[model samples]
Target: MCKEECPYDFRLAEVVSKLKEIQARKVLVQLPNGLKKYYPILRTTLEDLEIEVFLSLSHSWGVCDLALGEAKKTMCDTILHVGHHGQVALYTLSDIKIVCSPAFYKRNPIPLATRGLKLLMAKGCKRIGLFTTAQHLNYFQELREALSEAGAKVHTTQIFPWMPGQIIGCRFDTIVSNLDRKVDAYLVVGGGIFHGLGLFVTTNKPVIIADPYSNRLIEVAEEASQILKKRLFKLMEALDKKNYAVVISTKIGQFRLALAQKIRDLLRGRGKVAELVVADEISPSLLLNIPWAQAFVIVACPRIAIDHQEEYPYPLLNPGEVKYVLRGSLEEYTPKDSLVPNLSLNNVA
Candidate 1:
């Protein structure tokens, strides 16, 4: 991709200034796949500052996925991560410094917000809840003003780490629970169906996605329900499996060994064969290598099971869904906000 055509503000100057403030001689640069195209510009810019930059080839799903180990191994002074908020910066780790530089989308959201407002009004929605991802967070006030002026009651909440109207792939429960009853419909001013579906599954409200890229307003209630049905089917299928492979990711922030062990022990207590599988990257091919295990339970990221369910031939379940299997009922079947049971520094690598 061309640097001139890049739509996101990578805040390269801010990152360079921070590195200079810390007097970082060598640094590790990591970014999500979507932002990797700007690597050449990033590398050349930092090289001009006489900073030795080592690019991490590993994939980063979010701020939760950091390259701390890589930075440590390379003896770098700091790790500059792009494309996500600085939520992880709240926690202090070992010697290596972490700088989370967010990449904000430069696209105008007024047109998409106008389209969404019309759809929400057409649905007879008076009370509206607004949300978005990090990239589109800048448009929150603008969209909220547009909706409020249209005689719609708008509500939003800011949970620590996540900005107001911002939702990650796996986190939206707190924001939804706080405003679910107050709002008639939820509008996600961002790209993709993931965030919209996340809100729909967590609450009983109609979820609308204002995709600036597609220039369309989409309601994900039908699609989210379809996904829930598939998850329920997978959960039911997993109940009968005699053996299971519980997986734990080794990512700096995604590691959940305790939860994996608890799930493994839970299976063994129920007289089922359960083995712990440790991996840096979780994929169908990686799990398929172990044919003995009939089904798989990943205690890491829940999106892996929900978003990539088609890749695996067998039942792929998350830790939260495992409860329905253990209880032998579908009383509380929903995607979780946290990857592990109790999200804390202790549980992560």
Candidate 2:
């Protein structure tokens, strides 16, 4: 079972066994929207084990609210949070058990035959835009230089504001808004279809996704490609569309808002329309004046608001660059993003 090609094949059994060992009476299960498709199987598996389960779904901020709420209610003896890159906080457990599935896989190197990259190079791809899951953001600099030497320009926006070291799944609007129209195509160097699909949803131009574990570039197949094509056409038709606004807040003594301002300047320079709504703590109603934005971006130091109990209604955008931020100033803390090769399932939990 451990050697199964698809980890899902044996994961439930393993989870059940672990729960039994802990004598877990109740369990909490949290997942992102992307993984909602698999909830039926998960629910059935937990019920078979005779464990009471609570389900919570978050679009971007993984496990933060669910974990906190579970902690307050003392509702479960075990917790399982899935569909994230393994950044879990806001829940403290001295005795209760907690487990998380870090969906990390190694992909084979991308082949050079993909039409998107080929077309991009032909069109003189001097500058490139990059975004990824929060855990992988540390590698962006190396990736940037790699693409630069490959003759592509590179730019990255710390999209999520509140959680710096985690990926903000819901706040992809910032990435889309920051797209360099001057660049030939967008490059997403992360796992799964979500990252690629997010960028694809916002632009008609080419998007080259390099997931080393998946070993394939997401391209438009004749059938599935039509959906991507339609999405791209819609985004292109909506070009120069300014239907959204974002409010950025910063942590005390952290430079998150400064970086966000820089990103704002970059977006404006590219001729995209955007407005800085508010940069301070305020009610959700503060956004009422912005004319109903399509999305919002939050920029703050890692773990700043994790214990603060602040809440917001909009989707968040975290940069996943906490290590870099901390390394530049504080020396006592080890940056979580340090390179550790050949990541396995154990590394994620």
Best by TM-score: 1
TM-score, per-candidate, Cα-based: 0.91, 0.41
lDDT string, candidate 2, 244-271, tens digits: 3434543222235555565455445545
Root-mean-square deviation (CA) per prediction: 4.0, 14.7
The segments of candidate 2 whose C-alpha lies over 4 angstroms from its true place after superposition are 3-74, 86-101, 108-119, 133-142, 161-170, 178-182, 190-194, 211-214, 220-225, 228-349
Worst 10 residues of 1 by lDDT: 340-349
Best model number under lDDT: 1
Q: Cα RMSD for candidate 2?
A: 14.7
Residues 1-349 of candidate 1: C-alpha lDDT, one tens digit per residue: 5555788876777777777777878978898887787888788878888989999998988877888889989999888887777222323468888877777788988777777877888989978888777787767788788878878899987655456677777756677567778888888877888878767766767888988888888889888778777876877788889889998899876788888888888778777899998988898888889989988888777788787887897888777666655665665454542233432222122
